[model samples]
Target: MSCAIKTKNDHIHTPRDFRGGRHVFVNGNEIRYVIYADTKKGIVKYHPHPVRLKKGSDVVYTRTLKGLVTVEFIK
Candidate 1:
């Protein structure tokens, strides 16, 4: 799946600004981020990176139908 960061009202952007690292945090939870290698000209199939869930983070992560992961922190 791919990721898009919602910066402003009409300025949504892809995650290309982030390099290779799990340093992409949405709501205090870090997500595993990777630039899909098949993003060239005419690739159909995308081999997503292996999903490695954080073992014991106090956050609830949920996957949506639109290929985006949303995180809700536990209080």
Candidate 2:
């Protein structure tokens, strides 16, 4: 599958904004997922799965170290 991935130019200062929802590209298709932030632990969690693209109908992500990262999705 052919997927388009675009990352936001602006930086995400507040993790709360992710709570609203965000989109990501998975195998040339766009998929929406919810985000959760743990302020106390300084960790951000993406619901439904993490931000790794998989080659199937199911959306899955592998856990990784916490840090500043970019999320690219098809628009």
Candidate 3:
């Protein structure tokens, strides 16, 4: 599955334009944007939503320089 993004696929090396929004397909589905952030570590966030994977646990990860922002789908 793939999300519909206006960005050019060949422009992967360029920095993402924050002013422009992009679509992200997760787990073969086009999920909504829960949150976005830029940090040395991976994307992280918290919400009142329910996550079947964690069973109501905080999700965290270390992000790399491959992409401009690292996003975490919190439950």
- Give one clash count per candidate, in the order shown: 0, 2, 3
Instruction: Tell me the whole-model lDDT of each prediction, alpha carbons only.
Output: 0.32, 0.41, 0.35
| Ranking of all predicted structures according to TM-score, beginning with the best and ending with the worst | 2, 3, 1
Candidate 3, clashing residue pairs? 41-63, 42-62, 42-63
Q: Estimate each model's TM-score.
A: 0.22, 0.26, 0.25
lDDT of 1 at 34: 24
RMSD in angstroms, candidate 1?
14.0
- Report lDDT (Cα) of residue 74, candidate 1: 30
lDDT ranking, high to low: 2, 3, 1
Once superposed on the true structure, which residue ranges of model 3 sit more than 4 Å away at CA? 1-19, 37-75
lDDT of 2 by residue, 2-45 (tens): 45344462334233553234443333444344344332333444
In the order shown, the candidates' Cα RMSDs to the true structure are 14.0, 13.0, 11.5
Candidate 2 C-alpha error for residue 47, in Å: 8.1
